[model samples]
Target chain A: MADSPIVGYADALFSVAEAEGNLSAVEDELFGFAQTFQANEELRSTLADASVPVARRLQLIEDLLDGKASATTASLISMVVSAGRANDLPAIVDAFVDRSAGSRNKAVATVRSAIDLTGEQRQRLTEAIKTSTGKEVEVKVVIDPSVLGGAITEIGDDIIDGSVRRRLNQLRESFR
Target chain B: MVASLVSLMSIVAFAGPASASGESVGSCVAEKFEESLHHHGESDHVTSDDIHHVAHDEAVQDELEACLEAPSPILPELTEIIWGGAAFLILLVIMVKKGFPAVKGAMDARSEKIRADLDAAEQAKTDAQTVQSDYEAQLADAKTESARIIEEARVTADQLRTDLSAQAEASIAEMREKAAADVEAQKAQAIADLRAEVSGIALGAAERVVQSSLDADAQARLIDAYIDEVTGSNG
Candidate 1:
């Protein structure tokens, strides 16, 4: 993972977010934007398309992250997009989150839910993950409606799934 | 009998006077008899009875002498007998010289002809018998050939029947195997299709149920429940 070009981009984004003195907020905003970019095929295609003008792609990134992300997060995403690395945006953001979590001496955990979790729930989930892993963990929650209900937490290679969608899939497999 | 003798004697007396120039023996004998009878009549001057008896005796003696001098009535002339014997001998010699040989030659030729005809007929019979024997042998050979051909045909027919039976059996076996495999395949495919359809229906119904009951409170409850479950399990 560290040998990938995504690591270099993540490092560049990490350096810029750390220098801006808001690494955690930029990392969280970038992670949310990366999820949106992963889910939106049109946005990813537009950003990665070579025939599109670089200025236009940068403008589109600016427009999507306008008021929602900090200037450092927007600028880092715009730099990656302008560099024709939009298709690798999710990987770059994930690497950036991993680096940020590593600096705090914590493992990164990606959590998926059908609905937005309350602050208390996120805190409880982070503590639950840290207890389950026996290590400090930074939890990143992605609102994925396909989760249907409950949540699925991915910590390193481990997955703790408590999803209605997973239950339905298991039921479908049993029928076969 | 006496009249025929006298007619025969008269015929002889007339034939003798015709042949010699002299008086016939029968007339001479009658003159003598008459002379004697006149003498006797003369001598008998004593009685008439004695003279008649003497005349009859003299007449019988003169007739007897005349018969003695006549030729024998049953005997042929010597020259006629000799000539008849000569003629018979000549005819017998001619028959022996020419007719016997001719008759014998004709009989011998007829016998030879008969014998030659018999030989030709015997040869013809032998040839006919030989031809019949050859025909019988040929017929026997033909029968054997016919039997051999019939046997060969029977064997060929048997082999062909056996081969056809085997082929038919093989074909039937292959068809049966293929049919069994097809049935198994169809059965398996049907089972798979049923499983897929039932799974799809059950899954669709479960999704609907889950979607219907999932309100905001339920979602929060599920999240809290997941955190509690994970923390409890880990703890």
Candidate 2:
């Protein structure tokens, strides 16, 4: 059967990394790169500016992800920047992550927190969500200070919100 | 010379003969000579002689000197005074008769003309003043008419505005009343529909209870009792 376009890209990248024997490392690095690109507006605008030379934009991607990502992941990001598809980078990465999760028969669980969780806290929260949902979940944690405190988790259409901002909004609504 | 010759001939004849015809001729010649001498002499000399001849010729010459020594009226001098006085009186009469009347007539005519002109000017001025007053009155009337029209228009506009506003308010009130009536009717209809549904459910429940509890004969008896009770009440 023919795979989806996003699945094809993810399979190609995964096969290449597996051939190099660095699939897990490349996947982790690409996940962080996708989150960074999603969070930074200025970086996104610079990469998406049509007027900026493609070569210069590639260089910026290299400078941002060179040391922090696997060589294969860095090269893949540069390739995407050079192709003038920087705006689609986050979508492509998200699709790739989803494809990778589907291959393992796990649901992609996106978790946003106001601060970084400790290793023990992350493992406990992941296990608790897996137990509650009765499914294996690939937890993708995004540290977002705008959440104020606590965490908000989304597994498909199910949202488990435990943030201070959400509590305050509910309190304000009850008064109104 | 003729008169002296006549006189000398008469004197010689009288002295020489006394004949009847000679004496008569001599007297006649003497009378003719005296008449001629009277004609020849000047009047002044004759007057002196008349005075002096009664006395003597030498005495008349003395009287003539005395008369010259005294003041006498000369003819030329008297004639000049008389003519000058007559000419002055004539000139005075001519001025009164002709020149004075002509001057008076001209003055009267000029004064009459001036009076007529002044009368005409006064009449023209009065006419002009009347025209000006008429124009002013017309202007005032026009202004008053405009003011009255403007006031009437303003009153009409205000009345129209008031009528429109009243109509709008009444229409809005009517709309509100219609909406309230419609809402009340809908509520009543909903209540009626709910009551009909509840009545259906109640009837179904009552039928189930009766069918489960009663047999066929007991149902027929209950129906007959219900009919008899209704008929007895009607009777």
Candidate 3:
């Protein structure tokens, strides 16, 4: 998660976001974009394909995040893509988010859900995780249909798998 | 006259003093009587007185005695000896001319026959020895050939046994490997079947529960319940 090149890129992105005075917004948007990049096989492959030409890859990044992300977030992703680091987009973004959370003395928890969490549900879930893990927590939600229902949360190496998918898998394993 | 002559000879023979030795006197008188008989035929018969006068002649009696007293000659007569020698020479000439060649010819033929028989016997002995040599050589060759055949048979039997043993071992190994493969395949198929059944049953039941019970209100309640459970466990 914290290889040297990935940390260096993350530190540079964090410094840029902080200098722009929109660290929180850029970090959140970048985290969500990274999740999208990881989820979409075509987007991940195209962005990482060195044969696609840097100009074309940059244009594809701009088109994908046009109005969906802040200008600062789009520019930072384009910078990473143009620099041929698009293949490490998820890792760099994760490192940046972790660094950002650490500055505020909190841990980052990536949560996968079948449905989008309400604002109240997010606050409650965050509070519950902070209590359970004994750390100030920042929750990042990834809408994943494969979760089936409920949620699966990953905080560092620990995973809290509460999804119906996990329950069904356990039932399958019992027969063996 | 002949009867008177014979009577007168008888009386004169008895009256002679020399007539006491009858063998000599009788032989002389018989000779004279045969002469007188031959000289005087039956036509000239003489009386008994005339026969007595002739018989009393002393000169005739002396002459007969003198003839009987003379010694005989030792040699045969020349004419008889000459004839006997001539006959013997002729017989010897015939034996030399005819008998000797025939005897020699017969003896030569007998000797030739005996020599021929000995040669034949010798030739037969040599032929018998040659036949014996050939038979011995053939017997030796037959023994060598039989020994060679037996060796070949032994080698062939060993090779056949080795080949059969190897084939049997290979067959056993192949069977064992095939059996193991079959067991493994069955185990894998059974596991897959069990997994599919469990997945169908568990997923079907879960899907039904989620679809029927997971309304907006129920979803909210479940989320709230999970939050409460986490906080309570940690606190």
Give me the candidate number with maximum TM-score: 1
What are the root-mean-square deviations of the candidates from the true structure over C-alphas?
13.1, 25.7, 15.6
lDDT of 2 by residue, A35-148 (tens): 898889999999999899988888888788767877888887777777676877777777677767777888787877655665655565666766666768787878776555
TM-scores vs. true structure, each candidate: 0.60, 0.43, 0.54
> Which numbered prediction scores highest in DockQ against the true structure?
1
Docking tier of model 3: it is acceptable
Residue A158 deviation, candidate 1, in Å?
Answer: 1.1
lDDT of 2 by residue, B183-233 (tens): 999998888777766665665565456445555455334333332332243
TM-score: the better of candidates 1 and 2: 1
| Residue A168 accuracy (lDDT) in model 3 | 69
Best model number under lDDT? 1
Q: Per DockQ, what order, best first? A: 1, 3, 2
The pairs that clash in candidate 1 are none
What share of the reference contacts survives in each candidate? 0.87, 0.00, 0.46
Model 2: which residue pairs collide? none
TM-score, candidate number 3: 0.54
For model 2, the superposed segments whose C-alpha errors exceed 4 Å read: A1-8, B1-169, B172-235
Tens digits of per-residue lDDT for model 1 on B1-235? 3334544554554464345434567777667655666666675354556446654685657664864575657765565455446555655676677768888999999999999999999999999999999999999999999999999999999999999999999999999999999999999999989999988988888788888899999999999999998898778
lDDT of 3: 0.79
